[model samples]
Target chain A: MVNSWLELGAQKKDTPVKHNYSIFRRNCLMGIVLAVLLMSGPQRSWGQSEKPSIDFFSGFEVGLYDFYFYQKYNVVFNLTPGFKWNMGNHWQLAGQARLTVINQLSNDVRRFYPSMLVLSKELKAGPVYLKGSVGAFSNSRYGFDLKAFLPVTPWLAFEAQAGLTGLLTMAGGWGMSPMGRFTGTVGGDIYLSRWNTQLRGVVGKYVYTDWGFQAEAMRHFNHATVGLYAKWNNIAGQLGQEGVSLTQSLAKGMDGGFKVTIMLPPYKRTHRTVNFRPASHYSLTYLVRGMAQYRDANQLYYTDPEENMRDGWFSRDLLKWGSHTMEPDFIYKGKEETE
Target chain B: MKRIKISYILLAAMVLLPSLSHAQQYNGTSGFLHIPSAEMSHEGDARMGVHYLNKALLPDTGFLFQGEKYNTYDFYLGITPFEWIELSFTSTRRKDTRAVTGEVGFWRKDRYASIKIRPLREGRYHPAVAIGFNDVGTTAFNKERTDVQLYFTNIYVAATKHFGFGGNELGVNLAYRHYFRNYNDKWSGLVGGLSFRPAFFPQGRAIVEYMGNEFLIGADALLWQHVLIQASLIDFKYLNLGLCLQLNMLGKKYVVAER
Candidate 1:
């Protein structure tokens, strides 16, 4: 069982006992020499040929926000469930499993859990695609990401990503104290899968400091799927406390909302999978208007006058597949199913 | 004792000569815990660590916990012969924690080495440079101390609909550090920050740093399915809060290949 949970995590307690047992026996002898070099290298032809098929997705997402300058705008909710697997032939392999819940319409309410691993590749013509990702966020920090995508057709697409995240301490514990940062994003995605709709727009900048923008639109009928989201963040310079120079900090606001999803598939389909159909989803979002401003350029303080509007619901029954599975199902009834 | 057996055979030949060559495109594993700075006076120190990176261990090994005013407990090892080169080895058993009190059990040990560089390649906002060296031995009233360290890195880029967000990550970074004697002069300064990972926490993230002057806020919560949980809170001048945990070694691949 994964080497007895890595031998009980090398007997826990801040590990390091004999160098984590020689790094778990050198990663189990490098996983038996990469499984005997992929069972004696060189050998193809195994399901799906043609080399132009990249489709993998794992779901579960919940979000709600209303933080316009901290005045009655605190209703942040999140629940992410991910998995995106696509290999060779074209290339795409993503993964996810996140959970976040923050309620601050008034103040105090936090929770988070993140998991990710992604790699995407596709370029020919223009719809460009190139991605890379590294994970670790709830186990205790360490992240890396990269991105590039451009598809002005087949729906619409455009993207960009950056990286460097932190956390790696061994003396404190509220979660460790190592917060490194650096990020950038630009977005575009619009797919109307025959009214199944999907519209997105993003704009962010955290360089000289801060700026935010977000938009979402989803509509998938015949089982249920409805969404509409928006966002606008601010804070683009001057911020130094003890030594002064708060430069008005900066804070703007906006948030619209509407989410209604209902999907519950799976009665029994023993086999015959081309994207295994099994669903169960739910959502409720509502946040009307928000505002913020503690210092606009210098001295103009404005962080009150915040209106109230909040509502965020969530639900997930789990079980949805379709990443090329030939007899996949590791204990579905007893739970436990991952590829 | 023969230089502690040649520093454990050069830290086991710098961690098995990069897994004997080739193999390591992405393999990570992490775990951490370290708490010092109870406002000085040799505060109730504490330590614990773990790390592993692939491509022939580009970055590997580190274990620490030498509390009781540096009584004993410290072990570190990092290697990366190529790909910009990097080497490190730190050992400790204690010798001076405010000039030892009254010899309780007696102890002494130390070691060090470091070198890092990334002259471009691996872009998305590149800039890296590093250098370090340490060897503190002699006991009973000082007598052995070797030092030298310097680093300068930068980051600043953007994504996520330029300003309209959802899922896509947004970027920002600005780093700086300098030290050459003064043995950790107030830990140097100027460390910028800013980050946000959306897309439903694709591994989760939300960081903000501004070192040397204070203001460090962090978050990385991905519990299970590879595991993670890093947290932080720093108030410059002095004031800290931390937490750690991470593990994700190999397994999880696919570097673009779907057309």
Candidate 2:
């Protein structure tokens, strides 16, 4: 079946029939151009157009258990790799992928990992440059996110966000089914020099088969950020269980952790510039934290271990970076050996 | 002969008192009343009441009232212009037995208002549904927020028989209530209850109610045609057993010919 499908695709590509290869190729080229315009337009206009940009961040935390079964403190870790491109003016397109790992100390649980992909659009709308992400996380279970920022001053600004996250049935274990969760938060950011600091408190609710309250606080510092979150889930009622009867089933708990991120430059030319640089951007970040989780046994247990680690380092010089250069000047000038 | 006439008049007034007080003009009007239970050690427990109808009151306007229990007394009033809709405002005050540990009295009071509606009007056995939103203001908390507001909806079906004390009428009701928003978040449970009311009596009428997992019973009586009295006893299931009283403004009158 796979071979047949591939043969059909290849035949379509070779055929010059109407609505075939030419149209597909045109659409693909258009998509690539649009993506390039959106990702590079802002960075070319912003300051530091010449110097390559890189961001680095990381953090750590301690977890504690306060329940009936194995009660102890543990550790966790996380890491992220990100890239930012100036689209033009004060606008930019940034992309990041986060990898998280969790380890339980007492129970000897080896690894629980999740990943997030973020595509953010940032623009200066008045005094503050608003930033927001329109992306998906965890295999696209979560929906979209909308965020806004208003600068009280150049150094400080107020920010707010509304997000809908999907809780997959597999992720919720036995207690909760797959459902969408709504979250809203309002907070402020204080930029101290190159180091941008943010503090935000959030309140929201999860509406699944069962509905419950959700709250969280996050502090982001430049490339590194830390977050503390708590959820009070009530799933038993939807399963036809009475509230009083389910009160002893399990207790809600909190999860908190620190995360770091490294920003890498683009692999291609910074823009449609005449000069072609032979170096690619790269980043590496690490994070560690602890979580207090509640199990169905009505016990609070602390599970903490090295949570996440990520590394992304690359060099373009060996790959003849400018061989496929697109700019007219770069094509005409040819590649030069940097001694 | 004059003395006899005066005695007869007095007797007539006494006989007409209860009907005159309980003769409500509207079908779906709600009011607030304090509940006093004789069976419980604590006598004064107050609650708010709301009702709505389509056949009574104005064509479409309804009325509501709220009241609190002070020791053994309850005060309430209501108005409804529409038969299908009603609104009620209520205030309740009671001593907090659990707050005896502090120097200040554990007396707490709450004020709230609610609106209700009934959809089916003409059936002998009709299902009545109502949804209400309430803002609870309590004296115990210094800063009041809308965090504790309550959303409640219920559906009930009732059947009436035309044979009470004098072949008048009697109604039996069964209802299920789902509390949501804030109240259900704290107290999660399904409430099913039953109510019974007599059509008429020599003077007025009476109502008996039962609810909760444990058998809880409550009763209310109308007197002097305008005044109502009620009480109840609650069991282990957090059901309230209480009594209540209402004063009627309109009473029935009968004509007699002199011999």
Candidate 3:
């Protein structure tokens, strides 16, 4: 069959195959260049930006724990000039220089730290999406992190994540602790399509070597998300290191709170190579500390800057949202699927 | 004679009637003088302010200049992310103070946060009600850095009712303030205030409030709906002043220009 086809193709090769193939290749190249130019900046909305995003960012942090009559507050203004440059082949380099504009901490001058300098890659395994990152992260940690997400059904998804990090602080100079603590989480989510509600539960080992669980219920809105979360940890592993017995660890680790995340405007924009705007989403959490507890037990930090329930952060459903609408519809087959 | 006295009392209450509120309170929520009110700016409403706190209104952390100075300052940024919620971060500069612990400083700064939740809107049948925490978790160390003191920490509920009479308006506010963590609870008790906005001067509010231990009279004016300027007489004796700029980054404009 191959010999017969080769003789037939050799006889036709003299005809105009080469010229037509050259023109077709040239047109495809031009089309790709045109698309890249059109999608260079965050125009009209965040979802439309297809090219690398170089944006100016700012956020504020308030520290209330260090207050005393002598020094009441530490209000730091974080200025992050960051870039997410796609290095191609699903690998990217994202980083930010967190400069301090105002730091009223302990009568000392303001200080700046390097934040979120990571080289990350995205991969797909069958139906699951996986991501790995390495470099300095927020919460003063530096190391490597891995994540996997799978959407088994339209209304359910599972996620697994792990991080090996060490303490890095820029306070009073630069210092970094050895990377030894390994932390990981396993979680699943139930998506209620009709109500635009989601419920999530996760069990994880924290950086402090304590085991814990988190439960959250969130409501999705067009531009915002509101949710309540409860976190509980076993004091056993960490407290045992301090000389306390297993019985003393008990159930003392409990913290619950409400969170609100909102997307800021210019929801849509004209094209530009690099854009300047506020942080895409501002999320605020109000923690409830009961009378008995001196402080919260859970020491959790976000591995990804975009981690939030509003985007269903660790779920594949996020891939279906935003450019079209806040509520994903393609995968959310309502009553028809049940029927 | 007794009937005449009762009639005069009723007339006094009627004259001291009610005012509207936006988020221009001196301590930076919606209210009058040094207290918080049951009002909030629209979602996305943000304000940055600098205030000159009078000596009498300062937290009772005794210093060498406690009675002689009215020069402490503060800068705050407040925003309303939800229509019912208001959040703010404030840093107060304690200037030129010598603590009893033998420590002296020219610029000692303290930071605190405040939150307000407006659950009920004012209607003909009921007043607007709000629950708030002011400096909820603020504690400062003494000069020795050994002793800790909670400063300006308060939890309060405020109710405000607005009465309109041909463009001129009045607002009556009553609240109960509790010291959540502190030894000296100066402004922690029943507090009430009255606000009047004359029809001719729609941009300004004249207010008077008895803040538990002291009486304060103040007036705030909105300039071009964004710039807010305020002046007050603390305990009817010393002067306090404030200036703030309100910025609405998204959604609708924070204030409707009545003109």
Q: Estimate TM-scores for all models.
A: 0.23, 0.26, 0.61
Model 2 CA deviation exceeding 4 Å by range: A1-71, A74-102, A105-114, A136-143, A152-158, A164-182, A186-202, A205-339, B1-259
What is candidate 2's DockQ?
Answer: 0.01
State fnat for each of the candidate structures.
Answer: 0.00, 0.00, 0.12
lDDT of 3 by residue, A1-339 (tens): 101222234324643656535644554454345335323423222332134545455545443434344544446555655665554344556666567666554443235656677766555546766666677766666676778778787678888887766665554356454455578999997777655667888999876556878888766655666666777777522445576565545434556656767766555544344656555566777555422231334454555554556764333322442212343322212321100
When candidate 1 is compared with the true two-chain complex, its DockQ is 0.01
Each model's DockQ? 0.01, 0.01, 0.10
Q: In model 2, what lDDT does residue A283 have?
A: 21
Native interface contact recovery, model 1: 0.00
Candidate No. with top TM-score: 3
RMSD to the hidden true structure, all candidates: 25.8, 26.4, 16.3
TM-score of chain A for candidate 2?
0.37
**Over the stretch A172-247, how does candidate 1's per-residue lDDT look in tens digits?**
2123222234556778866754444567777765322345666777544433344556554554222343433443
For all candidates, what are the clash counts? 85, 66, 19
lDDT of 2 by residue, B1-259 (tens): 5634543444344334444122221111231111111110001111223222111111111111122222311122232213454433443332333333443221343333333455544343443343323321221221244564332222222222222334444433443433333423322233333333333333333333433233433334344433433333334112222222332111113211111
- Name the best candidate (by lDDT): 3
Q: lDDT, candidate 1, residue A26?
A: 58
